[model samples]
Target chain A: MEGIGIWGVPLAIFAGAIRVSTPFIFVSLGESITERSGRINLGLEGTLVFGAMTAYAVAVMSNSPWLGVLAAMATGAVFGLIHGFICKFPKVNDIAIGIAMMQFGLGLAFFLGKPFIQPVAPHLPSIALGGWSSSPQIQSALNINVLFIIGALLAVALWWAFKNTRVGLILRVVGDSSDAARAMGLNPDTVRLLATAVGGSLAAVGGAYLSLFYPGSWNEGISSGQGLMAVALVIFARWNPIGCFLAALLFGGAGALGPALQSVGVTQGYYLFYAAPYVLTLVILVVTSSPTRSLAGAPGALSITK
Target chain B: MTIEANIPTLPPLSAQSGNLRPILEWLARRAEPVAISLGAILTGLALFSIFITVVGKSPIDLFKLMYTGGFGSWFSIQNSLSRAAPLLLTALCVALPARLGLVIIGGEGAVVLGGVAAAAAALPLTGSVSPIIVLVVMAIAGMIMGGIWIGMVGVLRHYRGVNETIASLLMAYIAIALMNHFIEGPLRDPASLNKPSTTPLPAEYMLGSIPGMDVNWGLVIGILACIVSWILIEATSFGFAARIAGGNVRAAQIQGLPVGRLIVGFTALAGSFAGLAGMVEVAAVQGSANASLAAGYGYTGILVAFLARHNPLAIIPVAILLGGIDASGGLIQRRMGLPDATVLVLQGTLFVVILFCETFYGRFKIFNPDLWKRTA
Candidate 1:
């Protein structure tokens, strides 16, 4: 491979980060909303995979990638509904149920996705942000997906809504204290159920991005635990949507490090770089965690914090 | 609450029933878990049938194929038993840590690392060492690596207040990555060009089949490990302390039990069992550490542990049951034209329904002798 200039690696990483972080951004933002409501849906891994399959299958059948995204969102919401309803019952551990749901989703996807694997679906449209640049490398690298822009806007909107909207306040109140919500005559279960449903839909959008955009395809190995990592990303971001977006970019950069280095002909420990997100998440968790006290900004009623 | 007062008064049940009272009480005491678990299994089956029906396959045919492939003949039973061997140990990995109220789901990491460590240990003594000595060294290496792998999760949870579930899962991912790095790099055998793997064990050093059985010694070892773990958990003071800590960590701490030590020790032991399963796979089955070593035994073990309610002894039967389900996958695919993921769907459904049924526990007064006394 011809060596790119010294600045090429960094530039490549930046471009890769943008291309790769879309799913992370959506999933983490969704998880942030869900966690903000005091419930953890570890099963998002399943939701993400199922979404990828649904999106790919629908896009192939309908010849419309946008419809694929919508179908995935609907499927994801149904999964979230199942999770939320089951978790509503007393003594049902959300985390375990999440794992079970993950398996179910993955199994269902693989079983159903057998045919879609061989067919090609239309890729999601992307903007030629690097059209002005002379370099093809930069041009291709900077071609941003529309979903990335939408994800950024979603993050900003969520951040603003969490502080300014009455609906957001109700969600926070329900998350902070179920008793308080109940005292105010609000059914905490309903609120949480809805929050989880919305979260699930958002996460499916992330999956649609994966299958219909960057590395666009339907495969069992397409998602390397991105859904699960979103949970950790949410924590590191302190449950803030914009922070999730930024953290996702950081993770995407980490994920891109190996490919960028390999492009630059530095192949040593390439496989290890795939673990960068997980390791970073672990470090962040350890640093933020306190043995005697819950992390700052953690919802009062969150099972993880307790 | 209202129903208790409405019960018809007759002779005290214990006095009237005589010997039957004790038997009935015993049955009632155990009935809750049995009934709830059976209900969960049936519900899961029903849901899975609907899924199967939706997919244009007959659920009756699928179930029939599962039974025939899993338990129909002597050969099928042997296959299921062989598959259940690793699960026995891996399930213990979850069951033991669960005794300390920790959810350590990363046993897969330990299994992968342990297999790598065992392979590395055996490579040096390929020809010179006694086969038995080589096996011992491999087991020790595997156990230590596995122990440290899971022990870190315990230490992080207890000292740093990290969530055991997430931390362990992340560690598992890291461990798999590291294993891949080694298998594809430093440890790669030149002969393994198509698929990266460590050096295979010599034929003489490989674990052999048991007498009159097609299954390897791993099955026996797994059974023995379960027996030992059961005794350790149910009959010892340390186990008693661990159970107490599991119930209430503050109470255990107040009672001067070393809660941190218990957590780390139990997790380490659990990891070691999982690690042993890895070694057994490499030694008795695969004969080398490779990508295949990460064959999801760790994940399946989670289902087994939960289905068994994290009971060490109960894990034996549960592991076998799941193993049968797994063994039937290929046959179901071949015969019914359904995908191999069919069994996975069943397992996942069972897992969800079973966890949901946890709410039913302590709900029925008939299952609680204490409630009966109140009525009396």
Candidate 2:
């Protein structure tokens, strides 16, 4: 604390932003994909928590973190499938079902995760990008996890595929108008279901990142509403995968603000500072939301926008 | 006299003929919700039993212990009642707004803030004011704070078109953070080292039990609140308007109903109930505002309201029933070697199944009077 100079706070925040934003990146991107399909999955919070538990438990049992991640993705896909199938029924509210699914997922996780709380599972490996740096602080700060890089690449890939692929065209059509999709001889239910499954798997990977990498551990309190927040993040991102990535970073930076300030001996009201991300999100929503009009880039079939 | 005799007067109808059809029709109308909910609960229980068996536990023994712990004895019943007290008010937090088709799940935020506000308001009056006055002030403070906290969600939903569910939840997180900040910093009681609680109310200032019963006044207050809410929703024009709005917002607006006001007003009223529950907890249970204020009662209230189908009167029975299940957790944990989360699992299962059963409503021809008329 004594030897570190004026650059300490900025450096800490930059590193913290990267570390915290990784999960957000994955989740927001996942939610972006789901919402783009004209459906919203608020149950992602439950999925994320359940995924964390599954990852941790599997890691402990199989002695392999990768296997644990795969298990989490599989469970998450199943949860997504349930949500998609249930919501496919006429007069069924997606948002309400999402809340119910969230509770179910959380309950299931807590019930099974009680046993995995104590055991130490292997952590995901990191690539030390700061090896070239002479200062130990810089080196430590630059040790980025592998999932962040993968998530970034996935965002780019999704952006590219949405513009160039036939599957992307079908997804866009199904999301924008189910009636149109039917006219085009496509099954909107199946398309949305598959999209939601993919989204859920992606969100689970985000949870895996949490338990296997940064702040890495298997615990009931691991999520703190990150999965839910990602929904709002996707809104702020305006349904674009690249925008989702940026918004996640912004949220991540806000999330890291308190720790960065505390690192520099600014401890007063730190708990309030911990709420920066939520406050920022709420403020953004308020500013962007219009009572008379739907959001600019919202999908036509999205119930939440309506 | 001859003209009067020519005017035929039929004999008075029998009592059975006068009342039977209406009663039958009422029963027919109510049969769907009751039957569906019962079926859902049974299915949930069966699923839970299967899970228990898979985990190597005997479901029969667990059920026996649950009953014994929840209601088998006078002591257990009292415990269940005490637990149900907060639930009644919190369930109203969800139930009231639900009438207007708004889902406000942030009652937990209101409860925490309300508890903190009550404690803060009580700090200056310690030993200087009448206990009853202090209690009244605390209740008002709690209600005001909680109402404002949740009213913002309603306002946002109507005015800004923000999603109420997401906004309310995010606000809940913020409220918790605020409570933690204040409790640990500005409001920290010097004597409280580990838990970081506010100053405790004196024993005499604390709420007392009924003359002969062990349960505190919170139980009575909760029951009274439920009755009052029931009257508000059932016997008032305001409730009628809200119900109309819930059924179809466009029609409500076309009828010139103040939809925005109704949303804000109902949400505020609901928040006040949750706030009152917080005050009751501070006065009757914890005696101070702390992290313990978030005992998950607010979230459980959502389940209770849903289980009751968002009817204020129905909430009473559902809250008590769930309270019994919650009260049985410790007994099950101790006797059957099951984790405390087993109750949560059961609750989650019940919530999911009940919601899924919502699709069953109005689907049966027997429940529809129009269909009955066609058949007749």
Candidate 3:
């Protein structure tokens, strides 16, 4: 903030994008997986919040951040399992079921997280990538977390896997048509169940990143619908992992607009800028989506896009 | 829509039983939702009881407190009723759009913006006009704001093929942000420093309650809205067209139905009810627009709408029942050392179970009306 002047806004926004975009990257990538498997889990918001609570609580108890991340991943998987299991039943609406699961996860988290609100937990460490910079602002801005690097690599790996792996082929097949997957002697339900669980776990990692890094706190207001926003981001990304990564950064930048502008003394009506991400999401959906046809790259069996 | 539960083709009772078979079949068809929903509640309560027991709290005491707080007495009943008022309107928000094959979860945003709009409208005309006129203007302003907000979701769904559920929810977050902008910056009452709020309505301008009642006028308004909505959907041609579109958009298009207009109209109408709920809160409860306007009545309305199977008439009892559970939250917390979110847990469990029960409908032969026909 000091000595940066008006140039601080864009620099701050760029730095903030990298910092805030980690959770979006993880959740959108996870949602991309679940959507590709033809089951959209809108309850990932609940999973994200519950994962934050779990990670913070576990980190406080075990005095280990990595253990907290693992614990969060475990609970997220369980949440997805429950969602996937119930949705497997005929006549059940997956979207509604996701809403129910979200409420359940939120209730469970708040109830159990009552005790851990006060205890400060050990947080994840960050790598200083701006050692060459003499300015403290730039240096501090470049102090990126280890989880973010892992997320970037995960995006590349997932993109490759979706193209080259056998598991990817099965997932794509099941997503396209349950009947065709069954014809190929594959259990669509099982594949979707596993995909949803993996998606849930990745979403939890995003939550862990929030609690154990970035803001580094555990509270009820830790998430501001970012979990839900990831659902839209997945669509904006066209279901590609690399696209999801880029989309996350874009949304992250949009989200940071309000705070970044305010830092440079442009506080007038800046709260409206806080809405930039949502407006951007709406615009993206409007531009890309169509009334008569399915979105390009959307899985054939996905209930939502249809 | 979820309200379209198919009637059983077979009679639930045998003709060899008695002359009461027809009556029994009628009862069976009508009572199917009631019976299943009741079972879901019991199962949910049982699950919650297990959680309570595991946490070392006595489940019996919690239930007793809930009864006293929610429905065991007249005062609690009034409390529940007052709470149910807004739920009635917000439930309509979900129920209405649902008829057009849309899921609009952003009703909360509509409610928030509606309150802001109502407050803004009243601020300019408060002293210039009569109180009743102010109130009427408030309602219309709220409705218009809410309608436009949710109508956008409808337009997006119809014109752009956007997923209404996610789109609506995104709008809600955006609404909340805009609301904060107005509340914190533009509409802040200079005298009120601690909690940011709009200019308060004068005491005479506030909505009063019914005679010999603790509840405000919002409850009656909510009830009337529900009845009108029921008639609109069940007895009117507009409702029929909406239903046809809901059943199949392609078929409706083929039949030359104005499917796009129907979608937008239903969603706008639904958003109106939710917006009205926000106006009620401003006029009857809070007396001003503030952050509390985003008090989650919209989300709870979703639960009520679903539990009622999206039937406007059924939304009445369902809203009251859910409101009672919400009213009992504080009691459960004080008596059982459990957090108030215990109610949310119960609600979530019930919602899940009720949805799962959809699979059971038309599966059991005992609930079938065609059985009596065969036996006869």
Candidate 4:
């Protein structure tokens, strides 16, 4: 305490930011892709929770955390597949469908995952980026999860791909206008279907990071609104993948406020501090939204911005 | 079904003896929604039965237990009605805003805050004031608090173009957090060591059951609220304007309709119902504001509203159906050794199947009268 002095709180928060932001990054990036393909999946929260359950159960059963990740991705893809297929029908409200899917996913997860709650699953490995630092505090603070690094790189790659790739062009065309995508001879529905599945899979990876990594565990209270928060994060990022990475970091930092305060013995109103991310997101929305104009870079056909 | 009975014969007939198109068209139009809802609910139940069968539980036993526990006996019916009381109001929370084309899913926020407000408002009035005065004050306080909480979502949506669904959800999280803060901090009753709730109301002031039944006054209030909401939506110019606005906001605005006010008013009114539910809980059930006030009734209310197709009158039957399912949960859990989440799964399956069935509306040409019009 004496050696670290005033730096301990900020250091803990910095580490907390990186650790906490991993899930946000993955979910938001997935949401961005889905939105870019002219659809939105609010049920990602359900997917995230179910993914965590699947990951934890699989890891415990198979004795390998990576297998758990694959299992979660597969389950999440199926959830998306159902959502995408149902939404493709005429007059079906995707938002309402998303809500229904969320409820169904949550119910199924809770019912099925009840068995795996007590077991100890394998944890995901982390990278030691601070070998140069001798202090145990510094070493622990700089220890980063592999998923975080992968998510960061994926963000960069997605940003570049959205600009340069033919797939990106088709997605954008489908998102902006189905008629235009049809003119280009692309089936917008099929593209959106794939995009949604990919999005759900990415969100599941985020969930795998949750149960297999930091604060890792299989329980009902594992998710504290991270899935829903990703929607806000994607909106704040203006649908940019790189922006999602940055925004996730910001959200993660805010999420660390409570624990950081607790570390310093300022424990009063801790729950309020836990609400910082939501408050921040709400404030961002209130400030940035305009009635006369749609959000800049928002997918043209996105139901949310419309 | 009631709507079908109440509506006068609108299609003019030539009485040409052989022309049955108009009559058939009218009946088809009237029957489509009922058929869809019924079909979807059955399909959902079938899916759940398969899941249950796969798990080695007999679906027949489950449904039988559900019927016995929910609607079989007078006591069970009373239990179902009691639970349905809160849902009636909370369903309005989702239904009203829906008429304005806003999907607000955060009624839970209003419910918690409303309950807290009711308990807090009643705290000082307990001993000195009469029970009736205290109850009225608490109800009003609860409504106002809930109104403000959800009304803020409508305000944000209209004034700032914020997405109502996300805004309402975020606010609900914030509201719950705030409720917890207050309950565990300033409002904590020192004597309530285990639960950490506000001071409980006096026994006399607590809401009592109706004279002849085990059901509380909340049921009657809920029924009345539904009727009033129906009248408001169906019989008034305000509701007409709201319907027009919901159909097309741009068109409504061009016609000089008060779209913004309608949005705010309907949301606030809807939220007040959810708040009143919280108030009812505090007064009749919990006797204080506590963590239980944030129960998933708000979420279930969303299902009720959607099942009813956002119609206030239709919410009555839907809420009762959901309430019966909820009441039977305990029975199913006890009799079958199934977990409590079975009900949630059933609900989720039903909700998904219903949403999928939405594509079926107007799909059948028989339901569309224009297609049946023969050029005489």
Cα lDDT of model 2 by residue, A223-242, tens digit: 87788788778877878899
After superposition, which runs of candidate 3 have C-alpha atoms over 4 Å from their true positions? Answer: B1-20, B192-194, B371-373
Model 2 lDDT on a 0 to 1 scale: 0.86
Candidates ranked by lDDT: 1, 4, 3, 2
Residue-wise lDDT of candidate 2 within B275-316, one digit each (tens)? 889889988899999999988788778878877888988988
Q: In candidate 1, what are the lDDT values of residues B1-376, reduced to their tens digit?
A: 3566466864465445665767878999898899999998999999999989998889998899999889988899999999999999999999999988888889999999999999999999879989999999999999999999999999998999988888888898899989989998899898998889999999999988989988999889888988998899899999999999999999999999999999999999999999999999999899899999888899888878887888888999998998899899999989988888888788888888999999898899898765676323
Q: Against the true two-chain complex, what DockQ does each candidate achieve?
A: 0.70, 0.57, 0.69, 0.70
Clashing pairs in 2: none
Per-prediction tally of clashes: 0, 0, 10, 0
In model 3, what lDDT does residue B256 have? 98
Please say which candidate is ahead in TM-score: 2 or 4.
4
> Any residue pairs clashing in model 4, and if so which?
none
What is the docking quality class of candidate 1?
A: medium
Candidate 4 residue lDDT tens string, B1-376: 3243345754554567347765777788899998888899899999999999999999999999999989999999999999899999999999988988889889999999999999999998899999999999999999999999999899998999988998988888888888888888888888888897999998999988999999989998898999999899889999999999998999999999999999999999999999999999999999999999988788778878888899988999888988888899899888999977788789889999998999998787767665554434
State candidate 2's DockQ.
0.57
Docking class for model 4 is medium
The local lDDT score (0 to 100) that residue B46 gets in candidate 3 is 90
Estimate, for each residue in B1-376, the C-alpha lDDT of model 3 and write its tens digit: 1222246453444546768766888988977777877787888889889988998888898888888889988999999999899999999999998988888888999999999999999999888889999999999999999999999899889989988987898899899999989988899787767888999999888888988999999999999999999999999999999989888988999999999899899988899889999999999999999999999899878878877778899899988988898899988888777888888887788888888777777766667765434553
Q: Which residue runs of candidate 1 sit more than 4 Å off their true CA positions?
A: A1-3, B1-14, B373-376
Q: RMSD of each candidate?
A: 2.8, 5.3, 3.1, 3.6
Worst 10 residues of 2 chain B by lDDT: B367-376
After superposition, the stretches of candidate 2 with alpha carbons farther than 4 Å from their true spots are B1-21, B373-376
